[model samples]
Target: MTARPAKAVSRRPPRPARRTSAVRPPRAGRGGPRRLYSRVRRAWDRPLTAYYLILGGSLLITVLGLVMVYSASQIKALQSGLAPSYFFRKQLLAAAIGGVLLLAASRMTAKLHRAMAYPLLAVSVFLMCLVQIPGIGVAVNGNRNWLSLGGPFQMQPSEFGKLALVLWGADLLARKQERKLLTQWKHLLVPLVPVAFLLLGLIMLGGDMGTAIILTAVLFGLLWLAGAPTRLFTGVLGGAVAIGALLILTSANRMSRLACIGATDPGPGDQCWQAVHGIYALASGGFFGSGLGASMEKWGELPEPHTDFIFAITGEELGLAGTLSVLALFAALGYAGIRVAGRTEDPFVRYAAGGVTTWVMAQAMINMGAVLGLLPIAGVPLPLFSYGGSALLPTMFAIGLLIAFARDEPAARAALALATRKPVFGRKPAGVRWKTMRRRVARRPSGER
Candidate 1:
């Protein structure tokens, strides 16, 4: 048999049977779309994904806001005899300052966060009060919530108040939870409600029902997070509804907004003009949009093309696609906030994150609803996307706080360590660990056995 096989064999040795490989994993960061999707999904499972998601989402929206601000305000800026980049420049400055604040906030330790909680609340309250002083308080759009620092430098204390409430409320509830006091309704209601109510009173006095509504959301959100009784929310709900309705009825300006929502007048009234123009801006965009910077609405047809109704300009320029993109971005942000809030082991992180999420999301919904005629137009800017220095600064800072909480997670810690570790390729290993070295020494002596 061997001789027969040798007879058949050629000059070369019989080639080994072609070795078949076992199924190999697709190369990382390679392959078709499906493989790419799978890789991304897997990557998302890593520890720092949440932190990166928050950072990326915040940065994108902020940058988008700056671009839109420039586009939306250019015509108006020029019409006002100012530089075309006036609003853009101002917004850029605010964003720069806000980005710095964000980085600083994300790096703060938990102890520093806790330590600063009361001081933040105090500063917010003091600023809120300062806005009530004779000359310091400046009214805009009928809201006396602005602190006048001089020409072209007014700031909204109310925006900062939103963050202050979250921090202080989180601290308060966390301390109470430690003592098992959260179970008591009184402990739940005290301090937070009183102080929040006082703050709300001051805000309402400024005639800023929009800010008041957002603050109320923060207040209720913290309550719900701390496990307040259903009846408590019910009572609070009824009270809030009543107060909101009363406030709406009492103000001619707010009532007009209410009318704008329900107005059936074929012709737009002065009260309904802004709302009507917003609808026009959005509707005129069709689906894809009128084209960015090509919005007729932004060309003096729509009010607040860069500020409150930027969504309208977006809809007009990018069309429904643009508007929905804005909404989608906001939804993504809300999802991220929920993820951060839910994943935290710390009660303060949960409470504060939840409150901030509620404030931002609730405010967004109202602003969007108003633009859509589903609700009254509240003069709240669209969080990070709106062209307001006050709103932008605090929102970026809150995002930073969320980043800090995300960083505090166990997975994030591990990811950070891996990222910061020195590359292993060229470095000498610290000659075996001390314990291992000792074990080796002992093993050498035991070889006598």
Candidate 2:
């Protein structure tokens, strides 16, 4: 056995040593520390400064709103034998719901948003119609535009209508532009006439002139973005202004309010009373502010302080500095929105974003102007700072849309991801996956082989 083993033990020369590189295995698909590091790097690369400006501004305004609402509503609520926090609680709830909506809307794609435009517009129209129904529509301070959903949950469909109109109009204009048909008046009239009629008719029925004006502004913005004829747009603008003037003249209260702009000592219970009080609040606030919850006018000295006059209350509480801050926030929103619209190659997004920006910023200006007595009381609430569910929901959603655009911005995605600490790829369907197949050759049956 030993002899045979020795004879057979002609071991082959040792196989050449397999040389291996010293390199470490490719790090497993960015896991743990690597994944975190990559995310941090990506974030560092992408900054969402525009988004932060808008969102931070919104948060600041909302916080100030809570303080002002409580301060402004307390006296009224107490006089009416209700809790001081009544309006504050309602506003806080609305803000909470609005924040959720904003986050959700921010996550939606432009395509999905455009697809939703039709349904949303339809729903808005239906709700606006519902507000005309007796019993369901509650008259608030003589306006029959409010739908009472029972137990302090009243909504004004017209507020939502503003957003819907902007979305719908933007979609319509985008589509027409894509087809190179937007320049034709007939094509423009299709979406334009109905939206205008719907908004104007509903608002006229509800007597919500402020909202109607905002809707018109949104329409005009869309038209401008669609590259409508300058002459035609200018003509429309003139006509609209004339019509608005006529409407204001015909309305006794509106005319009186407008006349009261520079009047001193507007008598109590007069149309000018609120404006006078607002001016007083602003004057008293001066530079720094009267300090939170310390406004003199909010003690039943000012009307609708938590709504139309909330800005005045903010001024009175937080001062000129606060007012400027609020203004700055809105400016930031406008800038971000414009940037998004400009960056988007898609016409729909461009128009939609522009329309929304106009809708919101215009409304803000009107509200602030009204509060400062520079314009008549238009009954428009300060966006994100007013104490109305109707206004809060849509405003937050609009902000969300802006955030979505900002997030998707090509130049700023890295910054935005870093700021949000969220994945930039957005959400995807769960079942999506890739598969590989190995090729197999089949021989003919054994007989053929």
Candidate 3:
């Protein structure tokens, strides 16, 4: 065997680069860098643009939410004999925790994200189940979706379930893409849709139709992005509408809510009282608003002014300017999230980004719509702009995931590499001249310049 020796392997030569300009991008002929606006725009159109947009928007919204929460809650707290800052302190603590989660998640690697998906799904399912336990689950208003773990702090399992669903669905779809399973409708819908239904069933079982609707939005978004057939989408949408109608019909509360949708007078009970007062709050503010913490609605004129109806309070206090600013921030978030989904090469990134964007945008729309009397009173919280601790933490974490995806973009990678390189004695460590001059000298053969 040793005497037989080995056969030498041959390798193919590398292909030459194409000479045509079509193989390259069009460059500016001249003066491109001289235009400051164009230069800044080009710089901002890099891989990390989405990252900065998400960060700035999320921070602004969260801070604004804290301020508004305090403003809205102070009166109620004083009446309850608690300190004015009691609710404010709780919300600030939640924000701080969420901030830490955001920073940690932003630094997570892609592999880690994929790895955590399944476990998250399992854990979220278990938590949702636990929320059904008689002693463990505490009923708030009408929804038995919160867990009271022996303290002032309570956990809303459905909120974490939303995050888990995003991760798991993204991971599942990404795997399907790897296996080329996305093209077949059966392969695409199986398991994912069924699992989603299961989760939604559990959430609705807890009487949390609002959260269920948001989760449904996430499911619809993921399916849309996965390229399900038009017919299939229509069928699914129809089924959703039917289910929504049935849910509304079954509950007197929900029925009253629907009736109040376009009502100038919600009549008798406070079934639509919040919505009516919300409109009043906004109307009384006029254009410039009454000023921060100046909301008359917060003085028991409106209900849940710090939570589901914070946007109403915002309109009342901050006026049109403040409301528009809040809308602008949410628009920034939606833009950044969608931008990330559109630009990423990974299926997980695309699915996850789209799912989170849909969740946040849909929830915001529902919350604002309910307050403004456009939709039924859904009781959904505005993302990053509502006063719920459970909602804030997972949402901030999702935003962090979007940031992580942005940072992983190619331009961001290149920028990071360039920034990390140390310059040699006040000169760039790498540049066009440094590379080209040495190359030209080498081509001259005897160190000739």
Model-by-model lDDT, in order?
Answer: 0.84, 0.81, 0.88
User: For model 2, how does the per-residue alpha-carbon lDDT over 1-449 read when each residue is reduced to its tens digit?
Assistant: 45543456656898898998787777675477888988876754444666676677677777777777778788878888989898888888988999999999989998888888889988998988888988778888778898888786888888888888877887878888889997687787676866787678888888878888898888888878877787888888898899889988899877787787766678656757888889999999989997888898987788888788988888888899988988988887788788778878888778878988998899999998888777888888988888888898998898888888777777667544433442238532243221213222224455332
Which segments of candidate 3 are over 4 A away from where they belong? 1-44, 419-449
User: For each candidate, how many residue pairs have backbone atoms clashing (under 3 Å)?
Assistant: 2, 8, 0
Query: Candidate 3, residues 1-449: lDDT per residue as tens digits?
Result: 56986888769788998877565555554446557677777876876678788999999999999999999999989988999998899899999999999999999997898899999899889999998988888899989999886667898989999999899999999999899999998888888999999999999998999999999999999999999999998998999999988998999888888889967765886566778998999888878799998999889888898999999889988899989999999998999999999998999999999999999999999998988889988888899888889999999999899889988889878776654555569675433234442231112445444
In model 2, which regions exceed 4 Å deviation?
1-47, 267-269, 414-449
Measured against the true structure, the TM-scores of the candidates, in listed sequence, are: 0.85, 0.81, 0.86
Best by lDDT: 3
| Positional deviation of residue 444's Cα in model 3 after best superposition, in angstroms | 18
How would you encode candidate 1's per-residue C-alpha lDDT over 174-220 as one tens digit per residue? 99998999988899999889999988998988888888999999999
Ranking by lDDT: 3, 1, 2
- Tell me the TM-score of model 1: 0.85
lDDT of candidate 2 at residue 224, scale 0 to 100: 84
